[model samples]
Target: MSMIQTNDFDHVNLIEKVIENNYMTYFNYDEFTNKLEFENSISSANWNIIQNNLLINITDSENIENIIDKLIDHLIKLHDEFGYGFAGVKQIIEQNIQYINQPLLNNILDWLIKNQISSKYIFFHGFLYFNGII
Candidate 1:
């Protein structure tokens, strides 16, 4: 599919492609999204946590600011309460698995920052440097 249309970014379609490609992007979006979906299928609570905490809806009228801030707040709270960072997030995602997807963790941070989810990371210094969200 086309990457752009009408001089604007097609985020929804981009996300779909990212998931579909599932190659060596910032973190295998396909794997993670599918894993999350599967995990949710088994337990509504798990799904709800992810859906409510980190989920983003691509639409013209969406108030992304609120969701972004909420997600950052969630991460910050986790850090403040449990000292969680990439490791903690990885642990949550992988669950019983031995290995952790570092890229996925990085992507989460990148997503938060790139989307203005966190005001502190709002600067666009690494527009091309980042692998995930760009």
Candidate 2:
């Protein structure tokens, strides 16, 4: 009986593991324009690294891409009348736009452009333009 059983490294399993590991990590925002803060054991830097790595991996894995898409949509749906729930997520996305796939980023940008007039996301437009992502 070998204590260590070797199995093929599975990308789908990795994706699912990552998602499940972070599922309970919630968002917290004290102020806009600041880096996203999470109310969990993971530090902001760790979360940023996790997100960056995840987004980078998503470019190669359709499973990750689909899961991330659904996750973003679910986050958006969690927004309240004042749009509190996912603002931090948006901030993180904007700051880490380079890691995101072009099409997904475009969709996010389109949503931002459409809602900029009345939403906090308006603050990100200039940043994106300055960063040349817009």
Candidate 3:
């Protein structure tokens, strides 16, 4: 019996697998310069918009694009609210949502999770570095 099994790999899935298998990209932010460093060319406005959108969608969206579309909403939020904070960040990862501190948001995510939004869609922060093919 062969332990290894091969499967077809789609383009985006390949990218995801690469990101999942590799080391996480550490983003650098220059507060004085309003600059963020990562592999993607995400700007400040786009980043905020993306973060806001992520917060908006991660709760209820099931589509991969819709979910990934709004990834990493709290990188800046986390950075702003808690600079270099690991406990809060770890909580977000553990629960797959930002607003664990907020009861209303927590309830919303709880409802969404009960409805079947898998962490596969809701919990990916790796898009921070992945420059998706436009």
Each model's lDDT: 0.39, 0.47, 0.40
- Give the lowest summed-lDDT range of ten residues in model 3: 42-51
Model 2 TM-score relative to the real fold: 0.30
Candidate 2 collision pairs: none
1-134 per-residue lDDT for model 3 (tens digits) = 76976554443455456457853243334322454333463223111112232243354435544443343445446556545244435444334444323554444444444544565434433322132211
Off by over 4 Å in 3: 1-62, 81-84, 97-134
- Residue lDDT tens for model 2, 1-134: 76966554443455446558984344343322334333442223222322433232344345533534454543354343224334444554454455667776666667666766643355555545654547
Query: Of the candidates shown, which would achieve the greatest TM-score relative to the real structure?
Result: 2
Error of 2 at 93 (Å): 7.5
Residue 110 Cα positional deviation in candidate 1, in Å, after optimal superposition? 12
Query: Tens-digit lDDT track for model 1 on 30-127?
Result: 32422322322311111112323342232323344543344445545655664445545433333311122455435544565566544444632232
Could you tell me which 10 consecutive residues in candidate 1 have the lowest summed lDDT?
42-51
TM-score per candidate, chains pooled? 0.28, 0.30, 0.25
**RMSD in order of candidates:** 16.9, 17.4, 15.4
Off by over 4 Å in 2: 1-95
